[model samples]
Target chain A: MKYNAAFNPSGGAAIVGLGMTEMTREYSYSATGLAGIAVKRALDDAGLKKEDIDGLFINAGVTNAISTPLQTSLGFRDLKLLNHMNAAGSTAGQMVQFASLAIQAGMASHVVCVFADDPLKPGTSAGAAYGGTSNRSTGMASLPASYGFFSGANTSYALAARRHMGLYGTTQDQLGAIAVSTRAWATMNPAAMQQKPMTLDDYHGSRWIVEPFHLLDCTLVSNGAVAVIVTASDRARDLKQPPVYIAGMGQGHPGNPRQAGYENEVNTGARIARDTAYSMAGVGPDDIDIRELYDCYTYTTLVTLEDYGFCEKGEGGAFVEDGKLGPGGSHPTNTGGGQLSGYYMWGMTPVSEAVIQTRGQGGERQVQTRDHVLVSTQGGILDWHSTLILSPNADAGTRN
Target chain B: MTNQDQAVRPAPIVDESSKPFFDAAADAVLLLQRCNICHAYLWPFREICTECLSTDLSWAPSTGKGSVHSFVIMHRLFHPAFQEDVPYNLTVVQLDEGPRVTSIIRGTANEDIHVGMSVSANWHDVNGTPLLHFEAF
Candidate 1:
C-alpha cells in the first residue's frame, strides 16, 4: 500500500501527439471503429507507425473491454502493456496517468490512450452506456424509482446544485454565468457541438432538465473519440508534434468512500486530488496559464473551480461572473468548449484540449500564455476525481 | 389492486440484508439498521455496521422524520415508467438519526420544496409493492 516516489523514473513522461474523430451528434461508425481511427490518427500525429506503440490504454464508460478490437485493427504485435480503466469522465486523465506510470516503470516506452462513446445513437440507454450494470444498482436503486424519482447523471447533479444554492445562497445567475461563458468558448472552437452565443438571458430562458438546472446547464451527449500518445519526455522531444509534458497528475475518491449514494454533493473528491496534483507538479493555482475543467454539468465546472482553489468555496459565482473564464479573461478556461459546448468525449475532451493548447494548436481560441495548463476530470456523481498539470516543456513546472 | 405498473417501476429485489427493510415498509413502518456496538444508524442496509464494522446489526423502527438535504424536480423522463410522472420531486432526507435516505417529498409542489425543510416518511404503494416516501412535516 506504500508508494515510493523514488521508484518513478526521473525523466517523466510527455504527451507527444493527440488525435480525435469528428465530434458528431450521431456518428455512423461503431465504437471500435471510432477508437481504431483515433488511435491510428494519434500514431500518425506522432510521426510513428502502429509498430511504435508498445502499450495501449482504453476508457469507454462501462465498455472498457474494447481494447481487443482496437489491437486487432491496429495489428499491434509487440504490445508490452494494456490496461482498461473506467473512472467515468475521469477516464481520460486517469488513462494518461496510467500510461505515464507504465512508461516510468519501464513496462512500456510508448502508450496510446483513447476514449470513445456514442450515447446519442438510438436505443443507447444512459445506464448501459455510462452507468454500467453495477452503477445502475448503486444509487437510488432501492426506493427512489418507485416514487418516480429515477436517477441519472443530470438529475443527481441537479440535486447537488440545489444543495449548494441552499447552503451558500448560490444563485441561478452564478450557474448561468458558467453556462454562458462555456458557450462563448465553444463558439470559438470549430470542433464544439453548440457554438451559438448564449447570454445570461438565454440561459435563464432555456428549459429545465431538472430544476436548478437549465437545458444549457447540461453537457452534450455527442458521439466522438479522443486519443493521445504518451512516451518518455526525452523520446517525445524527437517526435513530430510538440510534446505536452506530464508535469503532475493525481487521482482520488474522497466522497462516498465506499457507499452507494453520493454522501456529500456540494463538496467532492476534487479537493484531495487537486492538492495531490499541484504538489506533484510543484506548482500552484496562480501558476496555471489555462484551465480545462470537466464541465459535464455547469455546476460541475463551478464546484471544481472552488475545489481547485481558483475561488473561495461559495465564491465561484462571483469569480465566474467577473469574466475570468470567458474570452479575454485573465484565466482562460475550456477554450475548446469542454464537455459543456465542446464534444462530450467525457474527460477526454479536457485532455485533448489541454494537449492542443500546450502545443499552441488551439487556433483562434488559444490562450495568450501556454506554459502551464491544468485539467480536472470527475466520475460518477462527483465521487471519483483526477487532475493533471500539463506543460510545454519537461521541466516546465519542476520545483527548484 | 392489480400491479399494472409493477414492471416499469424499479423494484427492490429483497435480499438477506434488505429483506427486513422492505418488510417494514410494507406495513408503512420505516426501519433503519443500527450498529449494536457503536449505536450508529445506516441506510441501504449492510450486514455489518458501516461505522464500527461490527457484525451485530439489527433493524430499529425509525421516527420516520428528517429534513431535506437536497432535492431535484425531474423535467425529463429518464425511463418509460416515469413517462406520466414528469416533474416529480426526488429528495435526499437527512434522517434525525444521522444517515441520509433518498426519498420523495409529498404535499408540496416542486417549486415549494427547499433544503432544510422538515419531512416525514410515508408509504408509496407501487402496484402491491410498498415503498418508502416522505412528506413535509
Candidate 2:
C-alpha cells in the first residue's frame, strides 16, 4: 500500500489512563452516571485532577444515553474540545485518532475518550434492546421490516456470514473455533463475563439465534462504561502508568449500496483501514505481536483476521480451524475474550484490552511479546472501520 | 390463538419517495427507481442517482427475476408479529437488474434455499397492503 504523508499521526499521542465499570446484565446506574464514575477512575489512574482534562470525546452505545451533557454532568468547565462521536463500534478508535491529532496540533493537552451504555433493561430479553425496530414503518424503512427482517445487526451480519460461507465454503465449525478460542481466553481474564470453559461441542450445541450464527456467536449484553485518557507521548512518560504509544491511527467508511457487484458483505472497510494504519505505523502485519480485534460475532473475528491480512480473504475459516487463536496458540487474538465473552462496551472492549496488554497490566492473560499491538474497531455491518497500532516503545514507528 | 388475538404483521407505510414503488406493488409489478440522465437503476427508492447525482428519476417495471445472493434462517423471534414464522428463510435476492432486494422466499423449504438459486418476484398482502416477495423458480 502506498503511504500518504498527510495521514501520519504516529507516535504523537499515548494512552495514559484506563478506567472501567463492572460489567453486568443488571442495570445499577444510568449511562451518564457510569460514565462519570469511569472518568473519575481514569483521572485517578492517570494521577491527574479533573482540571487537567481539557478535551472530552464521548461515544454512546445503542441507547444513545450518553452525550455532550456528560461534560457538564462531570463538572467539567471550559473544555477546549467536546464532541459526541458515533461511528458505531469504530467510535473508540476514531476518538483516539482525533485526540491524537488534536494533541499534535496543540489544540488540547489531555483528552478523555469514553463509551458508556445501559442497554440491558429490567424484565427484557438480552436481545430486546438491540432487536427493537427504531426505524419508522414507512417508505424504504418499512420494506425490510415488513418482510420479517426485524433484528437489526443480527439479521444483517447473519446474511453477510451466509454470503461469505456460500462464496468461500466457510463452515459452522470454522466459526465455532473462534468462539471456543475466545472463551478460552475469557477464562484467564478475571473481568471477563463468561469464564466457564467452552468447547467446540458446546459452541455447536448452543441455541441458534440466526441460521449461520449460534447463540455463542453473538456478543454479551452488559451495562457498563469504559474511559481512556490520551495525551502527548512525551508527557506520558511521566504519568503513573506505562504509556501505550499511539503508533498509528486510521479509519475507513465504505458505504454499503446493498446491490450486486458491491460485495460490502465479504470485502469490508477493514482492508482500507488496515492499509492506512500499517502505512502510518511503518510496519506490516508480521510486525504486530497481538491482535485485539472487535469481535461482535465469531464471523466478525474470522473476517477481520482475513481483512487484516493475517490470512487470505477466503481462507480465514481454514486458518482458524486449528485453534490458532486460543491460549498457547501462534496468534493471540481477543486476548481479553473480546466482546463475545468479555464485557460488551462496544469498541472500548478491544481498546481497553490493547492498552492493558501494551502496558504489561494484563496479569495472567498478557502476551510475552507485547512490543506491538493492533486494535481494530468495526461499526455497522462492516460499513465503518478504524484501526490503531499501539506499542510500549514510544519510538517504535517513524515520527512525523 | 384467535385471529383477532394474533399480532398484526407490519405493513409498508409508503412515503413520497417510495410511493410509486408500493403503488406498483399493488398492481403486482416490481418497480425500481431509474435515473433518466445516467440510466442507472437504484434500489430501496432513492431521490437522486447515486452515480451521477441526477434527480430526474422515475420508477420502471423490472423483469421480476433474480437469483438468491444470500439467505438466513431466522430461528429466534425478534418480533411478536412474526411469532409463527420462526426459522423462516430471510433471503436477499440479486436482481438481474443489478440491485438486491430483501424478501422471504416462498414455495421452498429453508434448507432448500441456496446462493444463486433462481427466483422471481411475487406479491403478498399484509393487512391489505401489498408487499414484494420471491418464489423459487
Which one wins on DockQ?
2
Least accurate 10 contiguous residues by lDDT in model 1 chain B:
B1-10
Off by over 4 Å in 2: A1-11, A133-136, B1-5, B79-84
Worst 10 residues of 1 chain A by lDDT: A131-140
TM-score of 1: 0.91
Kindly report which residue stretches of model 1 are placed more than 4 angstroms away from their true locations once superposed: A1-8, A62-65, A123-140, A257-263, B1-17, B77-86
Best by lDDT: 2
Instruction: List DockQ, one per candidate, in order.
Output: 0.48, 0.77
Give Cα-based local distance difference scores for all models.
0.80, 0.89
Q: For each candidate, how many residue pairs have backbone atoms clashing (under 3 Å)?
A: 0, 0
lDDT per residue for candidate 2 within A1-400, as digits (tens), equals: 1111122244378999999999999989999999998999999999888888889999999999989999989999878899999999999999999999988877788899999999988887676799666655678778788778877788899999999999999999999999999999999999999999999899999999888999999999899999999998877888899999988878878787776688877888889998989988899889989999999999999999999999998999999999989889999999999999998999999999999999998899889998789999999998999999999997877763
Residue-wise lDDT of candidate 1 within A137-192, one digit each (tens)? 43224555555554466678898899888888888998988888888998989888
Residue A230, candidate 2: how far off, in angstroms? 0.5
lDDT of 2 at A361: 89
